[model samples]
Target: MDFMGFFTKKSSKDTAKERLQLILIHDRATVSPELLDNIKEEIMSVISKYVEIDKDELEITMTTSDEEEGNSPALVANIPIKKMLKRR
Candidate 1:
């Protein structure tokens, strides 16, 4: 029997907290989930023309950024580039 499993199991409180954070992030961005996916796909299409990319490792999300004055939400993308494409 794995005693650690019992201790490490995710509690309901943890799950609810995670859900609440996601909700808050989405609300602050005022962006629908579908719209976000569309934007990500368009970005990938445009970037692919310039370089090879690891599609499976791509990540895009909206998060808060601290500016000179205050906190501002921004779109963040983590794209893994495989190689540069030679222009012909």
Candidate 2:
């Protein structure tokens, strides 16, 4: 057996990464990452109108799925809140 033959087969991790990259690209483009980002920013602005949040730490992602998955395109965002100071 040749040493290079050992590397011929694709690893599961590599496959998973490739799948994730493709899915993410498709999801973002189909749902529009810029639109999603704008939505998140608007939401943050609205929420800030009421309370405070760490905008820098916020995360927003869009997802798309086939009909067989029984789900529609979705936008998911995460916003982290800074803890308030307590009185001594």
Candidate 3:
């Protein structure tokens, strides 16, 4: 099996589906698209200083965890790090 193909890139349809999913997540959280985009940009800017990441593969979502513990909203970031930079 060609495992490398899996992570190299995402197809246009796949990208669109991911975007739609993100929009749905934002809608559920009652957050505007622009706000989420701004948040994503700020996060990427701060994280970029410490490590190299795959921007294309990055994903941020609003979710709730542990139903027993009150379903409070949470921001989840899935950042694919390409490399970790040494401390300056």
Off by over 4 Å in 1: 1-22
Question: Please, what are the lDDT tens digits per residue for candidate 2 over residues 1-88?
Answer: 3989657987899779867965776565675656666888789887776556898999776555558867566565677877543443
TM-scores of all predicted structures: 0.72, 0.53, 0.65
Give the winner by lDDT: 2 or 3. Answer: 3
Give the Cα error of residue 81 in candidate 3, in Å: 0.5
> For residues 1-88, could you state the per-residue lDDT of candidate 3 as single tens digits?
2878767788899889877866676677798868878999999999999999999999887765557867656788999999999988
Which of 1 and 2 is the better model by TM-score? 1
At residue 25, candidate 2 shows an lDDT of: 61
Distance (Å) between predicted and true CA of 23, model 3?
A: 5.9
Quote the RMSD, in angstroms, for model 2: 10.4
Residue 46, model 2, lDDT: 75
Lowest summed lDDT window (length 10), candidate 1: 1-10
In Å, residue 7's CA in model 3 sits off its true spot by 12
Better candidate number, 1 or 2, judged by lDDT? 1
Ranking by TM-score: 1, 3, 2
- Cα error, residue 81 of model 1, in Å, equals 0.5
